[model samples]
Target: MYICAFMLILGLAFYFGWSAAYSAWTDMGVYAVSIMLICFGAFGTWTYYNIDKENKANAK
Candidate 1:
C-alpha cells in the first residue's frame, strides 16, 4: 500500500517537473528530476521484491 502510494506520488511529481522543464526550456531541473525519478523507481522495485521474498519465506 505504501509502495503504491509512493510510486503514485513520485510519478505525479515527475510529470509536473517534466512539464515545467519542458516549458522553461531548462535541462538542469529536468535532468535532476529524471535522475531522482529513476532512483526512486529502482529503489521501490527493489523494496517490493525484497518484501515479496520475505513474505514467501514466512509463508513457508
Candidate 2:
C-alpha cells in the first residue's frame, strides 16, 4: 500500500517537473513544478520507510 503510494507520488513529481522543464512556458510554472517535486518526493520517501518497517516487523 505504502509502496504504491510512494510510486504514485514519484510519478506525479516526474510528470509535472518534466512537463514544466520541457515546456517553453513561463519560468514561474517551472519553479512550481520544482516545488511539487520536492513536496511529493518527501511524501514518497517517508511513506516507503513506514511500509518497509511494517513489512519487516511482520516477517519476524
Candidate 3:
C-alpha cells in the first residue's frame, strides 16, 4: 500500500515534469526528474510484487 502511494506520487511527478518540459521544450531538469520517477516507480512496483508473492507463499 505504501509502495502504491509512492508510485502514485511518482506518476504525478512524472506528469508534471513532462508537462513542464513540453511547455519549455528544453528543460533537462524535468527530464531528469521524469527519468528518476520512472526508474523508482518500476523498481518499487517490482519489489512490491515480490514481497506480495512471498507473503502468499508463506500463507500457503
The backbone clash count of each candidate, in order, is 0, 0, 0
Which has the better TM-score: candidate 1, or candidate 3?
A: 3
Q: Superpose all Cα atoms of candidate 3 onto the true structure and report the RMSD in Å to 1 decimal.
A: 3.1
- Model 2, 1-60: lDDT tens digits are 556566556656666666767874445655566556656666777777898999999999
Model 2 reaches what TM-score against the true structure? 0.48
- TM-score per candidate: 0.54, 0.48, 0.58
In model 1, which runs have C-alpha deviations exceeding 4 angstroms?
Answer: 1-26
> Which candidate has the highest lDDT of all?
3
Q: Which stretches of candidate 3 lie over 4 Å from their true place?
A: 1-4, 11-14, 17-22
Superior candidate under lDDT, 1 versus 3: 3
lDDT of 3 at 3: 72
- Name the candidate, 2 or 3, with the larger lDDT value: 3
Sorted on lDDT, best first, the list reads 3, 1, 2
**Per-residue error at 57 for model 2, in Å?**
0.7
